[model samples]
Target: MEDFKELTKAEEQIMKELWEMERGFVKEIIDRLPKPKPAYNTVSTIVRILETKGFVTHESFGKSHQYSPKISKEEYKKGLTGKLLTNYFDNSPKSMLSYFLEENRLDVRELDEILSIIERNK
Candidate 1:
C-alpha cells in the first residue's frame, strides 16, 4: 500500500469504470464508457499503471483478460481522501470540514441531517 501512487485524472476515469463493473475486459470497459472513450492502447496503458500501483489485477482466460480490483472501493476512497487532505487542506481535517461546509452549499435541513449523523456517531 505504501508503494501505491496517486492516479492521474485519466487513470481515475478508467478506474471508475472498473469500480462500477467490479470486473471487466478491455472491450467491456470501453463499451461501458460514455462518448469519446479512450483508445485501446491508452486504456491498456492506464490499466497496467493501476496494476503496478497495486489497485488492480487481471486473470488470464485463454486469449482474454478478466480484470478485477485489488483493493476495495472503500480503501481506494480513503486513499483519495488522504491525498485531498494532504494536498488541498494542509492535512487538517478541521480546515477541510470548514471549507466543505461553507463552500458546498448544503441547505439547513441537509446540515441538520449531517449534524445528527455526527451526534449519533458520538
Candidate 2:
C-alpha cells in the first residue's frame, strides 16, 4: 500500500467531492460544495495538488478533466487515525479509548455497544 501524505484542508474538501461522485469535472465538484462556495480556480488548483500527492487522478475529455480519488475514504481515515494515535496517545490504544470515554460523556448503552464491538473483534 502506498503511504498517503496528509492533505491540506482545501485538498481534503476536494477529495470528499471526488469520493462522493467517483469521478467528476471541476464544475460538478464545485456544485456539490456548501456555501459560501470557493472559486472555480481555487478548487481546480487543489485538485491538481491532490493529483501531485498521489491521492487523485484525472481523465481527460478534450480540454476538460474529470477527477477521481485514488485513495478510498476508509484508507485515508485509517492513516489519519494511526497518526493521531501515535502523536497524541503515545501509540497507546488504551489511553486513546480512555480519553474518548472520559471526554465524551458517553452513556452506559454506548459504552456497552463499544464493549460488544471489541468483544466481537477479539
Candidate 3:
C-alpha cells in the first residue's frame, strides 16, 4: 500500500460513521452523531472532501447521493500501521513491541498473551 494520508478530525469522524453504516446518505450520517449535530451542508462538504481524497465514493439516487467508503477500515489501518512502523520503528516489529513493553501499559496477563501469540506464530 502507498503511505496512508492523515485525515483531519472531522473527516475521520464522518468516515467512522460511514464505515459503520456501510453506506448512507449525508443526513443518515449526521443523524448518527451526538447531540450538538452538524449542519447538513457541513457534513456534505466533508463527504465531498473525502471523495476527493479517494477515501469515499457516491451513487446518485435522483437528487440525493448515497455515499460509501471506497476503502475498507482495515485496509486504511494497515497502511497507517505500516507508516508508523516505518517512520518510528525502522520497520522493525521487535522495536515496536519493545517500545510498547517499555510503556508499562500491559498487565502480566496481557504480556503472557503476547508471549503466547509469539510462540504460536513461531
Candidate 4:
C-alpha cells in the first residue's frame, strides 16, 4: 500500500465513523457523532478532503453520495505505528518496548502476558 497522508483530527473522527459503518452519507456520519455534532456542511467538506487524500471514496446516488474508507483501520494503524517508531525510537523495537514499559507501569501479570505473546510470536 502507498503511504497514506496523515489525517487531521476532524478527518480521523469522520474516518472512524466510516470505518464502523462501512459506508455512509455525510448526514449519517454526523448523526453518529457525539453531542454538539459538527455542521452538516463541515462534515461534508471534511469527507471530500478525505477523498482527495485517497483515504475515502464515494459512491454517488444521483445527488447524494455515500462514502467508504479506502484504507482499512488496520492499515492506517500500521502506518501510524511505523511513523511513530521511526520518529521516536530511531526505528528500534527494543526502544519502543522499553518506553512503553516505563511509561505504562504494567502490572506483573500484564508483563507476563506480554512476554507470553512475544514467546508465541517467536
Candidate 5:
C-alpha cells in the first residue's frame, strides 16, 4: 500500500491505461487513448514520473520500454481508502460505516446481511 503513493490526475489517467492493458509500450498506451491523444513526449515524461513514484516499472524491448504496474488497482484503491479514513474520518471505521449507512439508502437485504455480519463479529 505504501508503494501506491499518490498520483496526479494525469498520472492516474495513465495508470488507468496501464491497469487496463496489464502491460504496454508507450506507443500502445498513446494509441489506445481518445481521439485527441497527448503528445508522445508528454506520455513518456509522465510514465517516467510514475516509475519514479514506484507506481510503474518498465522492461526494455530493444528500442522501446514496455511499462507495467507495480501496484494492482485493488491495492492502490485500498491505500487510498486507508488514507481517506485516517484523514477525513478520524481513523474510525465505525464512524465511516455510520456515515455511509446514513448517507445512502441501503436495501433491506443488504442491511440484513450487514447486520448479520456485525452480529457474527460481535
Candidate 6:
C-alpha cells in the first residue's frame, strides 16, 4: 500500500471539488464553492498542500495553474476504509459488519442485499 497522510478538513473539501470538476484553476474552484466561500488564496494554498501530499498535480498555463486529482475518489475511500478496519475493527470484516448491524438500522432490503453479496462472493 502507498503511504498517505490523512488530509485536513480544508484539504478534503478542496479535493472533493477537484474530484467533481476533474481539473480546474484556483479561481474556478473558488467560484464553485457556496456562499461565504473561502478566499482564492485559501483554496490555492490547500491545492498546493494537496499536491505536496501527492493527492493532486498541476499544469502551468502561463501564470495560472490547472490542478487535477492524482488519486480517484474510490481509491481514497478504499484507503480510509482499510485504515478504519485495521485501527478499529481488529482488521476483521466480521467485526466491522457486526458493529454496523448492531449500531445502525438496516432495512430488510439492505440486509438482503448484503446477504446476496456474501452468497455471491462465497
Against the hidden reference, what TM-scores do the models get?
Answer: 0.85, 0.91, 0.90, 0.92, 0.80, 0.91
Residue-level lDDT of model 5, residues 1-122, one tens digit each, is: 33448788999999999999999998899998887999999999999999998999999989889999998999889999998888889989988877877988666688799989999999
TM-score of the candidate numbered 1?
0.85
How high is the CA lDDT of each candidate model?
0.85, 0.89, 0.92, 0.91, 0.90, 0.90
Q: In candidate 5, list every pair of residues with a backbone clash.
A: none
* Model 3 TM-score, all chains together: 0.90
Writing each residue's lDDT as its tens digit, candidate 3 over 29-114 gives 99999879999999999999999999999999999999999999998888888988988999998998888889986678998999
- Better-scoring candidate (lDDT), 2 or 6: 6
Comparing candidate 1 with candidate 6, which one achieves the higher TM-score? 6
Better of 2 and 4 by TM-score: 4
Q: Residue 82: error of model 2 in Å? A: 0.3
Worst 10 residues of 4 by lDDT: 1-10
Best by TM-score: 4
Better of 1 and 5 by TM-score: 1
Q: Per-residue lDDT for 90 in model 1?
A: 89
Q: Which stretches of candidate 2 lie over 4 Å from their true place?
A: 1-4
* Clashing pairs in model 3, backbone N/Cα/C closer than 3 A: none
The deviation in Å at residue 59 for candidate 4 is 0.5
Q: What's model 3's overall lDDT?
A: 0.92
Q: Model 4: per-residue lDDT, tens digit, 1-122?
A: 23646888999999999999999999999999999999999999999999999999999999999999999999999998888888889999999888878898766788799899999999
For candidate 6, write residues 37-116 as lDDT tens digits: 99888898899999988999999999999999999999999898888898899999999888888988666789899999
As a whole number from 0 to 100, the lDDT of residue 115 in candidate 4 is 92
lDDT of 6: 0.90
- Best-performing candidate as measured by lDDT: 3
The 10 consecutive residues of candidate 2 with the worst lDDT sum are: 1-10
CA shift at 14, candidate 4, in angstroms?
A: 0.6
Model 4, which residues run further than 4 Å from truth?
Answer: none
